[model samples]
Target: MIAPPARPDSLVRQDRFTTDESTADVAVVIVTYRNADSISTLVDSLRSEAAVSSIRVVVVDNNSGDGTASTLAAHDDVIVVAGEVNLGYAGAINVARSRIGATRAVLILNPDCVVQPGCVTALRAALREPGVVAAVPRLHDVDGRLSFSLRREPRLPATLVDAMLGARLPRRPVWASETIRDVAVYDRAHSIEWATGAAMMMSAGALDAVGPWDERFFLYSEETDYFRRLRSHGLVLYVPEARVEHTGGGSGSSQALSDLLTVNKIRYVQKYHARSFVTAFHAVTLFGEAVRCWSSKHRATYRAVARRHEWSNLLRAETPRPTECRDMGSVVIPAHNESRVIARTLDALADLAARGVVEVIVACNGCTDDTARIAAGRPGVRVLDLDVASKTAAMNGADEVAELWPRVYLDADVVITPAAVVDLVTALADGTLLAARPASRYDATGAGHLVRRYYRARSSLPLVRSHLWGAGCYALSEEGHARVGRFPDVVADDVVVDAAFATDEKIVVDTDPVVVLVPRTPAALIAVLSRNYSGNRDAPATTSSTGTLRHVAGTVHGPGTLLDAAVYCLFAALGRRASRRTSARWARDDTSRT
Candidate 1:
């Protein structure tokens, strides 16, 4: 296959088309909503176009319930399509075009658009070029400024940058976002990856070749995918001579639109990109959303994006063949007053603990809340309520009850994915690594400024490169557990476990991850850091950290990364100072417990 020729400095010039002399119909398809004012304005704009004779206008109303269909019905030539239910924009456009059957060209327009004089003439003329399948008019905002109507394919760095910092940065970076770079060609009539669906026209031949617009994409990226499909067969031209002023925020400003925009973006990426790229895309997008979510305006949207299951649904297999939880033995969780989040934690672990496959023990020690009651309520969970309030005692009690090889030490607040648990067990079955831990990702919802920056900075490091030093979930074979025997009376159980396993004996589960909840405020961060420092003082030196030369160089990402490092160091010093006041033997930071 040959590549398309390079676009010239300008589109090929053609004579203006005033009338349709050929026996073909030029159909105008408008998908409208609570857009009465725009529709009335569009009527006036369409009336002034002298060259658009014999054109048909069809309006597909998406249950706006605003009496828009009744108003459009009064027009003698307009076809009104009012339905009881809402078909999203792409679906509505499909309905409108299908109703206006066998058209020579279909011009799709948003209701809030005003066509300049001779605009339709220019677009129609451009469509007549040798191999051009579609044409889009140069679009400006209500104020006539160039909008970001053109695009390259959606990419990880570009989308993340656009989300974190809005497209128009004061000083553009060396790796500028796609939206920023696309501005250079906004004024030139040239080929593009895709133009906004708001004001684009498609030839009948193009529609026939590509079939109907994919309804799977309920709203956004429908046009992008459609244009991509069209480009696979023929060319798309941007006609600068033809101009349209768009009052852009139709579905855009709706509060409910954010979720749709997010899922559809993922859907587009998963459909087009490979699995490896999809995982990288999800990580970048989530971290960017998490950073920007600290702002009240975008908090809800980013929170939705932050849900791990949302990405796993698309990233993981649809029908995940149930994994065998491996022959290696028991799962032990130590809890103290964890009623609020214990249900979710155990719920995440239930499938793997099915019917004695793995002994599930929850050692609830000195809980002043209903944690013991709640954990005991789970079908496969065995809860033991001890008298003392100590994680060390709880672990010892759990070890006595479980008494099996390859024990899983887990925290009550963290949610361990069942599939990941199975994967870790299977990974250790080969006996190459004596002990293993699932890599962790911190859930940063409601985190303070310093804490937020820290996690976001940490996101740039390798996903599973760290050792199993202090992960939320780690498994130990009998040989591994014997190396670090019965729970020692220490501040951090994970620290002792890490000290026992050499770098070669421990494996970091890279495929599936374990999710942990991050502390909420700066004080909470200092508390956790203090305990960590106290725990490590008596423990062995860690063979892992976020301070490799590669990591330090990568930390030169923005002000945020540097700030994260600064804050992390400051808190470490503060924690060490604070640890002097607290008991070194028993310190577990549970600031996030509710």
Candidate 2:
């Protein structure tokens, strides 16, 4: 892994970003509190993505003592604003928005949310559809479990139902229904009433028309109120194909920030409903919460926060949004004695660039053939020739381009599709350290299909550490390469590089197939695997030697291991049978179609 670049003397400064005046189509705002550990990841993701052409990331730090301000200042792309105090979520967002003059849309994201590649693009596309005032992507947890962030607006009766009977009453049965009409389960793609603010994208037009978020309510229900207001104006909220992993609950110290939550809920009801309903609803709900808290021994904590008369003041504090610093990145492709394959790779890249994928910088190393010539012929593809034959040396030499922009290392033999590049860029945009795709090998016998299916299943297991595989066809942001240092000069350079970042950095394997072309022969396969084993031998063991030995023994003898082995054998046998049937069906289909 490459080391992060040195912090600039002074972070970039902007007056204010305006939705009307700004050329950027989207602006992402992250309200952060003590997020020093995760802020860099967020900025890195934004900087490396190519799908989002023009973006401004505003990070509002809520007076965190966690070195968050300095960390945000390190990035050229982020606008870091430090709050005077720990302002609640709404206050911090307002502070951030004060600096953002205008944008086509405002993307409200939690500091911990890691958006998949192309998620923003999908959200932007969804927002463009008529009447969509706001839209949210599907949210997943850290463990990749889906979190149903989309929900219907809470009615007064539903709130009363919950307040009176609690979980016993089937209040909000709309969420429970599994039918297609129930927006939660209808995954194919459709509209919805409201999505969680963990990662919501709202049109600038809608935001301006609705005015600022009601400052009376701080964190929760702020989104609910915003959605309700948008709906009142006859605009619709939607859930798009985009996805984000929300690490929820960043501000509060305990699970029961119940008083603050209750206060906000009361404020929301007061703002939207009639006085009678608000009074009745607030009384019942507060009483219900009081009962629950008393039973759960959380009444004191709730009462203490509510005792503070300045609860409303907590919602109004403002902070400025972080400014985006320019982060330039370069793409480095190391080519060997390839002339034929190099052109195809260059063509695919050119297509990507044409579609606004990424800027390319090709480094042709140890090519005895016309690899340099072919690379130079392509527009925007810079050719770097190295006299040495070593792959590690070629990659190290390519690091020279890192001086200009963050560098992404690419191999010449692999062809990256445009969609794959978009996916990778999107993942990088959301702050993934290293992003890659499974290598799709071509085969006429359908063995490739079977291998891919099995590989995917195995890869999804919790025990599997994906970065153990070498960087077959991968893209690393310049910052990632710099932080990680140069690729280790070894026979298995990729494996060594993977090991370097496996622990600290996020290595994302996008669902898309970025590299088409895998080892075709047994010799090629053995060479790759042997190099990996060699790297593994040289690499520092994460566990103790005793543990390692025990693990190895278990793999050879344990029942779970034995079962997995048996499953693999069964799958292989079944795949052969399935392949024969598929071939026969394909032949019949071809005959019928002809």
Expressed as tens digits, the lDDT of each residue in 345-365 for candidate 1 is: 889878666655567899999
TM-score for all predictions? 0.49, 0.46
lDDT of 2 at 238: 50
**What lDDT does candidate 1 reach at residue 68?**
77
Q: Over 4 Å off in model 2, which ranges?
A: 1-22, 48-50, 164-172, 175-188, 290-297, 301-594
Give the per-residue lDDT of model 2 (tens digit) for 1-594.
Answer: 999897653233232222344556678889888888887776666553323446777888888888989887877556778777766677677777777765788888888878777787888888788767777788778897767566665566566556555646333475432111333463756666766778888888877787766443546778778877777665554554687777776664553465556666665665556656765765566565666675553465345333322242333233212212222334567777767677877787785444333567667766788889988888766678888876667777777654444345666766666544544544454354454433333222322443443333333232333343433465565466666686765654555556556443544332234443433333333333344444445555445535433433433335654554444344534544444443221111111111
Off by over 4 Å in 1: 1-24, 170-175, 180-184, 308-594
Best by TM-score: 1
Write down the lDDT that model 1 would get: 0.71
